[model samples]
Target: MKVQSSRDFKLQREVDYGTPEQNKAVKQIVADIKQEGDAALFRYTEKFDGAQVDSSNIRVTEEELKAAYNHVEDSFVAAIRAAADNIRAFHARQKRNSWMDLQPDGTILGQIIRPLQRVGVYVPGGKASYPSSVLMNVIPAQIAGVPEIVMVTPPATGGKEGIDPYILVAAAEAGVNEIYRVGGAQAVAALAFGTESIAPVDKICGPGNIYVALAKREVYGAVDIDSIAGPSEIVVLADDTAEPAYVAADLLSQAEHDEMASAILVTPSQRLADAVAAEVERQLRELPREAIARASVDNYGAIIVVESLEEGISVVNRLAPEHLEIVAQDPMALTGAVQNAGAIFLGPYSSEPVGDYFAGPNHIIPTNGTARFSSPVDVDDFIKKSSLIYYSKEALLRDGSTIIELARREGLEAHARAVEIRLENEAKGGVERGE
Candidate 1:
């Protein structure tokens, strides 16, 4: 890790999110999938993953799902079930019902809340098995009453023929049965445009490599996506009271995620900064993903010595990290100052991983400074809203003149006439009936 003063540190780091060649390749892949459907999917699976896929092996069978349980240990099952319970309970609170406001003037104004018919969740399956991602993606859609939650993962894990059993078990536990063995931009394309084997989904949600992120960006209008995520990031705001070892370890946790991952420590205390910098280097040697973590820390990570804790908060807001840990003496007091971050972890105990796996909050957080506008995946992502308006004779007549005036002012004669005709009919009927 490198140390620098706040004035010298550059908060933003340049990254090649995707090269032009990669973007062009993904565009071609998406286009091929759109045009050829199942044929394109098979070709890409064989080309990128060296796996075979056809009508017979496109979807995971019930027998394979059953065998998944046999492969995992009993402890893994118990842990996932417990985590599922917590996730369900948390998301259930976010579930909403259709509501209408009936006015005394015989008018109704409301919104109709309905879940999407189907959704596709893409879980990356190349580096490691992320059963936690299964829980994070599926539970919210399930809570929102999405009828069919289809999932797509890579055809192989660790260069093997089949998907990881732990991933299968997690999907089963999360109540997702429609599993397809596909991945990368090709899977995203398959989800956006329906194939003979897989139906189109209303929305797609999850994180993947740059290819997957770019694919989601390309297919946004065809299908809603969570967000075009970037590399993982963590910005820790610490003070003299903060623990050096704990801060170093938490920073490394995210650094190991990828070479582009960032981990920064912003503090006012020079003593704490020196201690954490030393601890990070000492701990980096022991990590199994040392090469990746070291690259990340060297290129993106930093320790900034600020003049005051308030200035440190400003730096944190500027970075807009995916995960933020406030390790100050009064962490909660600075909560309002944190305007941008995907998730906030207060105190030494609330490490980043607590939210990543076990915490009820969705781990699929916005990255690349998008936290300024976007949000994590939630039940609302799986549902759509329709405005419901009912106008009775009395209400329409009361507001008819205003509607006509506004419509005509906009040079919309048809719109104005639509209201005028109804009012004319009501007037003529009243006159004829002598009411």
Candidate 2:
């Protein structure tokens, strides 16, 4: 582990799975699933996940949930339920209502905000099953008044009849009515196009591997997608006052996510940089995922010694990390300067995982520099806005010529003629005497 400058190290490992060739294959899978429905989904599930999922055991049932609940430890279930309650409480405040404004001139215009009718959430079931992610995804849609919140995850190693107790308990706590035992690109396709057993959805949310992301991209038009999510990443901006051990631990947090995941440190003090580098080496030896973390830090991780705190913050903005931690003299002071970042952690106590698990905010954040112009998954992403317009006779007459003129200029004669015909109809009916 060594401390260097930003220009000295640049590790950019983009997803090699979603190439044009792979995209073509994903498109074919989506088309096949769309055409074959359950048969294709079942075949792909077995082929990809090695799970023998069938129409008989497609969705989770109440009986299974009750049994799984009993299987999980009471205290852990209570904690997950508490987290779900907090998540629901925060998202409930984001619920919106359809509104209309009536003007003196009788031009009624407003917006109708409503939730999507159906939504599918993908919960990755690899090394860890994130029931927290279930809470994050489902609570918002439920708050927004969505009728059906369907979920899909790879079958747990437990059995065909049982899933991970944590995931099952969390789904129950999060108010998810439907759960499917399927994963990988096949699960995404099944949700997007619908199978004989699994119903299609209007929008899909949550995180997954590269194959899952590519499947989401493939079925985008058939169903709306949240975003093309990428690997985990973090950028920590620290000063001399920042603790080295804390900085090292925070950097390694994202690093352990995957080999390609990035953990970077930008500081103004060279001494602080060296200390943090040493701390990373010291801690890396003991972390459970030490080899993965070490490889990530060695390749993608960096420690840039900047000229000043301002320079360090500049590098942070340029990186636009999925997670940004500010460990400085006054962490809040640098928040305004933080033009980029999916979620900004202020002060030493606010570690990256705080936002990931327990935080009320949604954890499905924008990644791979998309934070510069994007935002974390929120109540807004699961919603749709409609423009409500009501034109009174007076309002229409006043605004008709402008519309007619614009239509005529655009060579839309039929549009202009439609307005003209309406005016004439009003005149013929003696509604407008000034005609």
Candidate 3:
């Protein structure tokens, strides 16, 4: 891992975030599903998932869940439940309340906070099940007081009808009531438009493959989506005092997510940079996901040796990785300047996996450089805020002229009259609004 000495080290901003090919494919999938409905979904499920599926048997049942409970270890179930509790606790703080503002001029403006009513969580299961993801997706919506939380995953080729039971256990703990045996663009289609089997949802969330992301992109306007997730990334900002082994281990943790995952290190100490690179090579050979981690690190990974600590942080703000680990001399001091980043894991002890599995903070984060504006999947995403105004006749009269002029200026005659009628009635003491 060679470090380019100057600021010109970074390659041009050529990272293709979301491609046109992906956009084209997603649009067609959404259109096909909308045109054919259940027929389209079943065709896609059988084509993509290598399983026999239909609209008739999409929802999983109690007996299947019981079997999942039987298959999973007791300790594993206990741990998942504990994780759910912690996740719920963290998102509970994100819950928002409605507000109404009153003015002496009788102007009233406020917002009504309401849950989305229904949301669907997509858990990718083409290779292996992510039980932790089941908790990460559903708990936030539950905390937001969403009435219905549904989950969808690809059925296993080994005759699994729905999501894995360990996933089921996690979902149960997180308060998800509906689980579907469908997957891929079709699953997104099912959630976007109600079929005979799966109910439509207000939004779809969770991590999935390229096809899932493409589907989310296609159905964006039809149903609200959390984010068009990209490859996972972690940027470790370390100093000489940081452990090279720990830094190397943390890099692999992100790298093992996939071949496209990016693991970067920015340090001022040339010795620490060399040590971390060597440690990464040493540890990569000992892992089962070595091929993946190696490929990822070799390709997108960086060990940039900046001139100073401040310069290192400047690059971090520019990248705005999905997971940022601050392991410098004083991580807190630079945190004030970190305007971007999906999640900040401060200190060496606060590793990436801590946020991935156990930490109450959400792991479903913004990716593909979207951390500059987007945020992690949280309670706020599952809820909608609607502004409300309740003005008494006297109150309307007090500000009626101003309201009428503004509405008329905008050419909304009806809007202006709506307030004026109240004011006109108020002058005659017709309606006492507060009473």
The candidate maximizing lDDT is: 1
In candidate 1, the residue pairs with backbone N, CA or C atoms under 3 Å apart (3 or more residues apart, or in different chains) clash, namely none
Could you give candidate 2's per-residue lDDT for residues 1-435 as a string of tens digits? 667876675656664557788788788888889899999988988887777788999888888777788778999887887777777777778777889999999889999998899999998877556788888888888888889999998886355544787888888888776999888888899999888999899999988887888999888888999998877899999888888999999999998887778998998889889998899999999989888888888888888888888988888888888999999889888899889999989999999988888768788888888898999877887889999999888887788888999999999999999888777777787455575
Which one wins by lDDT: 1 or 3?
1
Task: Write down the worst ten-residue block by lDDT for model 3.
Answer: 8-17
Residue 292: error of model 2 in Å? 1.9
Question: By descending lDDT, how would the candidates be arranged?
Answer: 1, 2, 3
* lDDT per residue (tens digit) for residues 1-435 in model 3: 455554756633334435787767767777888888888788877887777777557777767776777777999988887888788889988889999899765668899999998899998885557889888888888878888888888876234554566777777766665788888888898899978778799999988887787788778888999887888899998889899999999999998888888898989889999999899999999989888888888877888888888888889888988999999778999899888899999998999999999988989888778899999988899889888877765676666899899999999999999988877776787766693
Runs off by more than 4 Å, candidate 1: 14-17, 430-435
- Residue 76 in model 2: lDDT: 82
Q: Which ten residues in a row have the lowest lDDT in candidate 2?
A: 156-165
How much is the lDDT of residue 119 in candidate 2? 98
Q: Tens digits of per-residue lDDT for model 1 on 339-414?
A: 9998999998999998888879989898888888888888998999999999988999999999999999999999
TM-score of every model? 0.96, 0.94, 0.91
Give candidate 3's TM-score. 0.91
lDDT of each: 0.91, 0.85, 0.83
Which number leads on TM-score?
A: 1
